[model samples]
Target: MDRWTWPAWVGVFGGLLVFAGLFLPAVVWQSRRYGRLSARRLLGTAALAVYGVALIAYTLLPLPSGDLAQWCAEHGVGGVQLHPLQFIADIRRDTAGLGLRSTLTSVAVLQVVFNVLLFLPWGIFARGFAGWGVLRSTVTAALASLLIEVTQFTGIFGLIGCSYRLGDVDDLLTNTLGGLLGALVAPLVLRWMPRPAELVQDRGRARPVTALRRWLGMLVDVVAVSVLGAGLGIGWTLVGYALGDRTASAPEVLTGLLPVALVLWLPLLIGSGASLGQRAMWLEPRWSTGEGLARGNLPRRIIRGLCGAGGWGVLTLIHGAGPALAAFVLITALAVPFTRGRRGPSCALTGAELVDARAVSPAVPRAAASTDR
Candidate 1:
């Protein structure tokens, strides 16, 4: 291969690795979580599709090859046949056999630095979407690079047609290391963008509510919580069964346990959502003078949600009907005060003192509101 060709292949491989690292998981997770799709995601998918097409074109298309002598003969532009083995040979020659001293030199350091910088965006986007801490981000990055290397070595044969691509394991190591470094830097980068994570304190005078309105809101909250908990519990049980025995039918289990699962999730979901969802929906949970909705940080929300779901799991194990059902009802009833008053349990847990949004000038831009929330 010509000098230019070798570098071009490297560039292509690196670009594809980075693109896959950033976009593939984004597509899967976002779709699962929100159900609602965005134009940006659509465009991203389109771009990836185009890249796939280009890879096919590059692999199947003919290209000019041979020395200047053959070209000058005017018989025809000498065409060189693409071969996978030749590409692999070239890659090995270029990257293999470095002395320890050379490996530790400035050039190697720079290479490592460049690799880390290349995947910084991947780490940032992964952390933003997954809410996965550093460990998960690093593991994900490593797996992405491994997939790319495997694809290259296999000549994209699994899906796309065979191509003249040389896969190197070193590439995976370097790429993953890069992503890990990037993950370390993501927090610092996000910190500089303060408006993206500003906490909104919802404190104000309690609005008067009719008895009917209060009753309806309570019903809605309880129903929503129960349904979510039950679904999650039954879903988890099915997963556990599937993992334990391949012949186990997940749908059958889900069908049988759903009612109990709903019973389990109801109190937790309503308890947690009453305060947080109300805030998100532009409503407040207020009582006598104590002030705003409880802070209900991410950890608290996750715990409450999981606890509600777990309540159903406990019911499943104990095989009791009356007590389990009663406990769920009791929990839901307890959450009502938190949903209603300023000093409710949720508020006490979160330390959120509400303030009037109207009184505070809007410092956050509408464009950045989603991130802020």
Candidate 2:
């Protein structure tokens, strides 16, 4: 129970860390590929992360430590059980002259069951979540089982210098069988999961801009600016150390200037005039009444930038302005839901509308038709 419980807890902790790290990237990918996020798919992704960590924890955890020779002699499990279906004979011998319940409860029988159940999720995930065929899932499961067996036999590729667990051929066979069974039942188990093809079918079509989408995009921009600032600070400190200037510190101006460039200058000069976060969320700014973001539209672009994430970035650099920045962010977030097209503070202020980047402009079709004539 301790062994199982410990690994389960470890899996939960590690899984959450994995989920947190992948959350933003996964959201970005889904928004781009599916034109909208699916809560069900996101939940599935989270489950996958937990399962992945649990797999590692159960297989290779509680590593051998301290007084290697003594531990190996007294407690270590070594050598290979190469005979196929050996567990059947072992179970039968142990259960001789015993009742049905006793046989079922015996260690030999239970071990085989545990091994089988361990690989079951692999087939389910491969077939249902990953959309793999039955044969492929089964074969892959077999390969994974084989790898685990080899690793155990070689004592984690000679890391511990001796095997700490038996490499059993019976375990491999049972594990593969479990995976095959799982694959066969995957459809029934995962009936609610959306097909990848269906999700991407209308990916190029426009989606309505929502407050949640706006908030997520803003979050991405904030995170990007923070990451960029941290990275630049680190680089500056490293360069200073390399130059033997122990007292050298990052310049206040460069940190502020670079973030402004990232959120403001670069987007204005580049395609679609969307911040990095907005682009990731498949959103862009468009003039509400007339021309798109063109070279001659410098003033509008500047106004939009100053009112959006770029402005936030600049404000963050000012000393003793934390409260003001917080207020600005809070007000903008609150304003999003009330604004037309769910526009953020920037769009509302500049008379620009937020739209899905994939949405085709109304004038594009007419211009193309004219060219054909």
The numbered model that scores best in lDDT is: 2
Question: Per-model C-alpha lDDT, please?
Answer: 0.44, 0.80
Clashes of 1: 11
lDDT of 1 by residue, 1-373 (tens): 6532444354456546656555434433332333222345444444444444333333223332455244335433223334423434544455568665554454445444554554555565455433467788888888776666565544344433332344545555666776677677766754433221221121222233322232333344444455555676667677778688545444534543454445443334453333322322233321122332233445555454444434434554454576866776566446644553332233344443222222222232332222212
Error of 1 at 324 (Å): 56
Superposed Cα deviation of residue 318, candidate 2 (Å): 3.2
- Lowest summed lDDT across 10 adjacent residues in model 1 is found at 194-203
lDDT at position 315, candidate 1: 51
**How far off is model 2, as Cα RMSD?**
4.6
Candidate 2 lDDT for residue 160? 76
Which regions of candidate 1 fall more than 4 Å away from where they truly are?
A: 1-114, 192-373
